[model samples]
Target: MAQSDTVVRILDTAEALFAEKGFAETSLRAITSRAKVNLAAVNYHFGSKKALIQAVFARYLDPFCEEFNQELAILEKKSEVSLEELLEVLARCTISVPATKGSLSVFMRLLGLAYTQAQGHMRRYLQEHYGQTFLRFTNLLKLSSADLPDAERFWRIHFMLGAVVFTMSSLDALRDIALSDYDEKTRIADLVARLLPVVTAAMQAPVPEQPELVKQ
Candidate 1:
């Protein structure tokens, strides 16, 4: 087999094993055996076990972030970046783009594991490297909601983001509940459209008009 193909195989096996098991539970020998590669291949391509895990994550995470930024850039060029545009970009980049069945599920399961189980270098690597995407995204949100106070902005974005992420992970369940009429393939786009307005409403609340004082 070609070296690149070997590398890809190793990554695929590692992602599945790591997700189903975990960092401590998974071992390099198991990954290599599953991939049909030797220990040398894993060492050659990924350098170490921790690096291999990071590579598996980057395999999915990198492209997703790039697509996100690309979509945002296009929107920013077309017009002012509204909360609507932000929501749409997120829905499209995140929930809608997984081409194959079960890809999103695999990613979500693995990602959920990473949050709870992975640690030390693994956790730090994800936060320092992959987490940059959110840092950049938050700046855009700041631009979109300049009027919101610091505390309000922080919590609002927090709640909105948590809703979006968790929902994407459980989208199959969500469709059964909220959108029984649609298939999973179609549901993502529809969900994005339907939730966009509701989230926007949550973002907006009545701002009290300054009371006019009678002249003394």
Candidate 2:
């Protein structure tokens, strides 16, 4: 296989494996076996197992973040924008990533894995790479709610992130439960539509004042 094809295969296999089995459990041997590449190919391309894991995440996040930033730039160019408008763009950008069926869900599952399981170099690599994307989004939220205190803005954004990450990670289970209990057809495409309103609401939720603690 061509060098580029080999690299792509390794990344794809690694991502699938990482999503299926946690990153700590998936091994280089398994990735190479699934990709049909030899051990030397992995080392040649990625240098080490941790680097390979980072690359697997970058393969998805780099493009997604790029597209998201492009959309954000367009929104910035507008005369006016709202929290809801910016968040709607965020939701649409993710759902619009071109891939085979269920690919987005796989990406989300991998993303959740990175948050809860990744450590050391693996976690730091992602934070270093994607940190700006997150910062940009938070800045936009700040712009959207300039009147709010810094603490309020921070808490609201944190809640929004929690909502998005949890919802994406639990999509399958949520769909099954909804289907069984309510006869609801919660298709993947429907997720962005459902998620937008909920996330937006969280971002706009009223921040309560801290009550003073009495002296002990």
Candidate 3:
């Protein structure tokens, strides 16, 4: 096989395994075995497991970030952007990315794993590479929800991320449950549509006044 083909095969195998088994549990041996490549090939191509993990994310995130930044640029030109409109731009950019190796659900599962698992290196890699795009989005969010205090916005933003990660990572299961329980077929786009308004509302929620602590 050609060098690029070998690399793509390795990446495809690693992405699937990482999404299924997570970063720590999935070993290099397992990845090589699945990819039909040897340890030397992995080392030669990626140098280290940490590098490989970051590469896996880069495959998807690189394109997604490019598209996201473009959309954000257009939105930035507008005089004002609503919370829902900002979120919709995010959803549109995310869904527009081509999932070559697996479904978007797999991509989301890997992302959730990166956040939930003890992958400090992966977090740093993301922040280092994608921090600017993330900051831009967050700045736009701050502008859209200008009413919210900093602390409240911080918590709400994380809460929104948690909801999205959980929902998208478990998308297949959620779809199955919807089919079995409600006789309804759910699509990924449908879920995003449903999720946006709920998160938008949460982001736009009224900040509650701090209550006084009672004496013990």
Q: Which candidate leads the pack in lDDT? A: 3
lDDT of 3 by residue, 94-118 (tens): 8889785336878888888888899
* Cα misplacement distance, residue 27 of candidate 1 (Å): 2.3
Instruction: Say which candidate scores most in TM-score.
Output: 3
Model 2: worst 10 consecutive residues (lDDT sum): 97-106
Q: Using Cα atoms with residue i matched to residue i, what is each candidate's TM-score against the true structure?
A: 0.73, 0.85, 0.93
The residue pairs in collision within model 3 are none
Misplaced by over 4 Å in model 2 are 1-3, 211-216
lDDT (10s digit) by residue, model 2, range 34-148: 9999999999989998898887777668778989999878876877689888888888778776666666777777777777874667668877888888888878878887777
Count of clashes in candidate 2: 0
Off by over 4 Å in 3: 1-3, 211-216
As for candidate 1, its clashing pairs are none
Model 1, 150-174: lDDT tens digits are 6787778766755665666676677
